[model samples]
Target: MSKIETSILVEAKEPDTETLLVLNDIPLDEQVEGLIRNHKELNITRHRSEKLALSSGPDPTGLKILPASSRQRFEESGIDVSRGYPEVPDRSQIPVFVDQAFAIRNYDLPYTERGKNADKDKKSLFGAATEVINLTKNVGTEIVGLQLENLTDQQKDELALLIAERVVVFFRDQKLSPKTQRKLGEYWGHVEVHPQTPQVPDLPGVTVIWNDYKIKQGMNLNYSNNNLGNWDATKNPAIGNQVWHADLVHERQPAGYTHLHLDAIPGVGGDTIWASGYAAYDKLSDEFKQLLDGKEAVYISAHGYLDRDDPFSGPKKVERVHPIVRTHPATGWKYLFVNRAMTRRIVGFSPVESDLILNYLFDVYEKNADIQVRFKWSNTKTGYGTSAIWDNRIAQHRAVWDHEGKDARHGTRVTSLAEKPYFDPDSKSQRESLGKYLHKWE
Candidate 1:
């Protein structure tokens, strides 16, 4: 990521005169002037420094006064009064407009110290060098040249930041062991233990995802010997594998980073795709965005995935309420947090209304090819373990089940739980928040 080298200068011109806040090196055309006029208490004028100075005081012709509510909303949206107001987009650039209040509310404001530490020292044990390949404009990045087992503390921290920014990062030929994978997951946060899924017999927290076509066939034979219904047609697990979802969203504090190591895969299939929540949220109209600003949704764990009767597991039915749009705690970017698998309904909405809104929102993940990254696992024949680490807080993924009953696809998964989801008005969208990083690699 590149360093930001700009500052907003706010200075008092004279003792008794109004405070003059200068937004340096920014264009001030008619559209900008009109936007400034929309916000009372701000008056724009040309400055000697080739900047636009906003004067705030008490003359009727000088500056209009802002009400307390407007000031609070402005501050909450990260508009720096001492620095300068957010840049006004041209008429052609505005996406949607309902009212002046809605326009101002949906504006993408600038942070006072945005991207200040983007260029910090990132040297690590891997010769202080790493290669990054962006897979999409906003969703995924592939990092090469570092062994996961040999990562240093600095490298781990850097990788965490990259994964958080990119949403998902892929590594090829790492062949990380279960112990090493557990260690790698620990670097980001506390590794989660699935409430009901079976773990590796000897490896404690590692969950084994063993899918073998031969083994399934044998199970079906046994079911036939017992005169049970057709296992392939009636009880196939692949029937329910197409849902797009984030891991463990039913928990109060859901899993943040989930690492999946595909050690074995089919020859031609078993590709996984992830969609960016930030992109989904950003593509919504301003009216829908405002409608979902502070709304919450209900997420319920899949039935039979949890055992409420089991004292150790605690609950058979698990449910939690999270913001419909969540701001990632680390990067301060908003993301669409609801998903098809766990999210059941929007809170405070009628069932019909919830279904209508949610179905449309779910299409953002399912239909938007521009906001997705698909990765195919083709390195299984070489015995090189391919791994994907992703921020479940800001991404939704689905496994392609086309290889069912034809080949084996096996892997191990580990998830790290993070803080509960929330919406911060000051946070930007992922693309805007990670613009420098994306541009650096581009």
Candidate 2:
């Protein structure tokens, strides 16, 4: 082969020890010349490999690469490079992907243009108050700067839709009295007392989700069963919810929304995480989805109430079979309808067959954790006051109890909404993409 002619020279503005070490295999003056000749080829090969990684069909292995320049910056800034990256979708691209998925289910209706008088056409409450701040395009929204102590019925409805849309909604510094909190929950729908939880004597909707430490503080039989007394919700509320699922999916009628009011929060490191079933379903391939249509999975809350040995309690448990694919009642959108905690198996299938299908679905849901949004509690106010509302029908959530004993926290939760979980066969709209409704991702 003939040697290619080129004119390039490496020049160090200021050579450092690391920089010199990198060039140790070659003469410093020729480093740039060598890179110019070879780096472009190396980059092309790497780009091709990364693109192929996306489609080799679901490899469970996790690998991540950070640009050398970015890695160097982290080192210079005293950041921990060894801490590494979690396997997550880059947030910036998520909205685009979700929006694309939603586009598949779009109705043929033409887009309507709202008139300048649109705001005037409707009765105004709070006189032009900004009730919801879209926190992220695909993950979260915060009910802005408003107190839940006394919202109008309309506002409550508005909050419900926001939760349905964002999947998770947050409120801060809310100092509602226990009575006020319970009353607020009433507006959303019927509130249910967790079968194992005890209601505060004065506030019917507010039930304390107890931890072991809380039981020691003179909490009576009203809240603790001798069997479940040592169990902790904060450590693993998913003891029931962890299964890829919607809340109370086993009940004849699943709940609409569940609210958790943080009473006492630790100083640091407690957060709640949620993933979108809507988003998860939206990301599937046509072939993959074809396998799920019309399927039904049996859901049971036995996992949540771990000590199922109380055979004498006459099955104080909830079990039902929900459609493997579900449509959101209000939004009319389809979503994956399995939960890690509640979904047990596919009905009518042999045990081996059920295991294969359910595990695949479970793996898909768990892998999509990248599309989830995590809300870290602010210790300053995560005290006996602040709360959050999540639409359990359309979303799944988990609490992080990593702060055990670091900073003691407690809360009262109220689940509202009488809408039993039902498979809306006719309500499934094609996947709804959120592309246009997004903000910049992290």
Candidate 3:
């Protein structure tokens, strides 16, 4: 290969004998030549050749010796060097030169008509048939102009892609029944039967989340019997509402796509917030990321669920170990898997050490508002039919309990079963994977 010449402008001061000896000992590559100077500011030129010899004199203070290919040596000596020379500009700022460029002959017409032909030729996947509105830059997207009950196979596949990419997708004014809701979930995967929550009487896999304050009824009957002692709703309602978690994390294969339709919501309260797991993982520092790499955590089912003898609650005291950092099977992006509801402790760390690290990790999800999106359910005036489908692998959701004595908030949810949680070494980060969709609105 031909010699590639390069010069670095280094701003350095005169060095003492010991500093000069340290600089001279720096090893150079066989294909590099160094030209060093001892002036107030030095310019070092490196080319493809053998290493240059150091100056040999009693007073080597003003020695002008070239350094080899080792830039670290100069950096260690506190010398600043330029990587390369600046490029010269080739374009002029003159307007007359620009006016001679290509111009539209019909520029005298209206501005809107200038691109009329181009507008007619544009094409897209959904065309003008469907409208998609992004709820936030990170987590949720609201899709309009299509009903969930009547979706074609192609539209079903497209909606699945949107759910995977956006983390959660919302639909307004959806008139879907419990059986139809279960049918909608079947397009994605097998509808999961919730272990703890009560299912609909007629429908098999559909779970009901009913919070009727009028009859003093709660979501889970067992929790109502215990007066919600696990959450301590009377003492601290804020803490009770802030349990962010994915559904059935104790299962060997957790849920994937969860579809929830709220046909009856209160007038004032009952809002849900979702946080992006990919964003949580991306926001962590490199040191913390390396520490959590290839690590596992223990998740217990009974720890989060209040009902013990519900029969459908699977094992009463079941424990499963999953990767702390898991990769979404569909998107192939890494996301933080530990949640405040199910995850107990890190697998290998001591009790004190695990608590410290897990608390810091939990704060990353709880405190960061930039990575979260809050969605409020529609009231009775709006006809009370709002549905949401979310990817459980890349998101964690929490319900806000502000409608304590005001009204009732009831909903039907169906979860789709997915593969076991696993880490993919070749997967990209959440930010890297969703860069295009995050800026779709802009």
Candidate 4:
């Protein structure tokens, strides 16, 4: 017989003669059952016993999927640890919408500033005009009249919270350089690096969300009429502006907010709409809740992999499976967590079943305009600016593409802190309040 593969024994002792049975020669499930029937508890769990001898890979008992070092210990505990375990975020730790908003608004505010340091500081870094405006008892608020191009570190910290609270914030009449725009984004957190865009030389936070032609220095061809397949943002970069998404939700840490400075406006239609997930969940029937209670979704970006300019080719994709109904960590509210832009499937269902459910959810987001509010743009002969901030955890938004030439519409964008998106199922009161502002679908 070939040499047996065994762990090193620290102290040499009499090995069990029965333990030397040709187990490898026989099937493992058979061996386990045999040991169990013999009532040999010690033999039941061998040093390197496979968790599931008949099964193909690692077992899915939640904790085994933790960070690298923990998984190693699980292997030592006689559990199979060969395959990589997927991240399963803690559903119980998700934050509520209003609480998240409050945290963001309060990040850098001074609790007490009455010392020599206080006198030295003329004013807080963020100017008065840039402070976040709380509008209602409901958590929706506005961050008015600030130029994000040159924000202070404190302002960036505060702005990160703002984005985390409101998925997207607005700036009216922003006039700042792209370099500065990129700089402000750095203060918040990691900026997503689009696979297709050409790197901006020394720029760290400025990841290009470019199409094939742009990366190749090709002409600026408008292919806005392309059909969407996988809903990955990189599938069609320009069209990214048209969908509703929490930036890179599949990522371990997703974007808290996206800040746009609207400098350009179409003469006719250039409006963007936002929908509240918290409001949407509150409006659902009890039966619907039962159906979605334990369901999870698979978010994928394979469509981006197919693009020639994409950084990765073939099956190289980014995917995330998250609970469909999640509780916000900060606010303790339950929310419908799927989005048209990233969510792809429902776990435990066949492909057909998953598609059907995902389609239904996507329609819910599209047709239920009541939970959404639309922000329209108007071009003034006199140059001016306008902006709106909406919570991403509980909000969905889409931009309108209708426009005319010679009407000059333009804008700058600065993204802030990409943090792990979370949910809370217990915060029902705030979610209920959102129903009052539901938009009537036309």
Number of backbone clashes in candidate 2: 22
- List runs of model 2 lying over 4 Å from the truth: 1-132, 212-246, 303-317, 379-384, 424-442
Output the number of the lDDT-best candidate. 1
Error of 1 at 5 (Å): 71
- Which portions of model 4 miss their true places by more than 4 Å? 1-127, 130-145, 149-167, 198-201, 207-240, 306-316, 377-392, 404-412, 421-429, 432-442
The weakest ten consecutive residues by lDDT in model 3 span 42-51
lDDT string for model 3 (236-346, tens) is 222233467777676666677899887666678778999888888888766777789789998755222112224233223346788999977656778898776566789
Compared with the true structure, what per-residue lDDT tens digits does model 2 show for residues 1-442?
Answer: 1122233333466664122213345444344334423333212111111211121111122113332432333344353425332122222221111122223212322211111123322234334445656565566766545678666666566656656666778887766565666676666666654422334433445665534233232223221232231132212233212223456665555566788876555557567777777777766765667677778887764322111233223212335667888766556677887766567788788998987777666666666756587786563342225677877766776665556435645556787654534455565433434333222224
lDDT value, candidate 2, whole model: 0.51
Give me the runs in candidate 1 sitting further than 4 Å from their true place: 1-130, 213-240, 305-316, 432-442
Ten-residue segment with the worst summed lDDT in candidate 1? 43-52
Candidate scoring better on lDDT of 1 and 2: 1
Distance from true position, residue 359, model 3, in Å? 1.5
Q: Which candidate should be chosen as best, given TM-score against the real structure?
A: 1
What value of lDDT does candidate 4 attain over all alpha carbons?
0.46
lDDT for 18 (candidate 1)? 52
Model 1 local distance difference test score: 0.60
Weakest 10 consecutive residues of candidate 2 by summed lDDT: 44-53
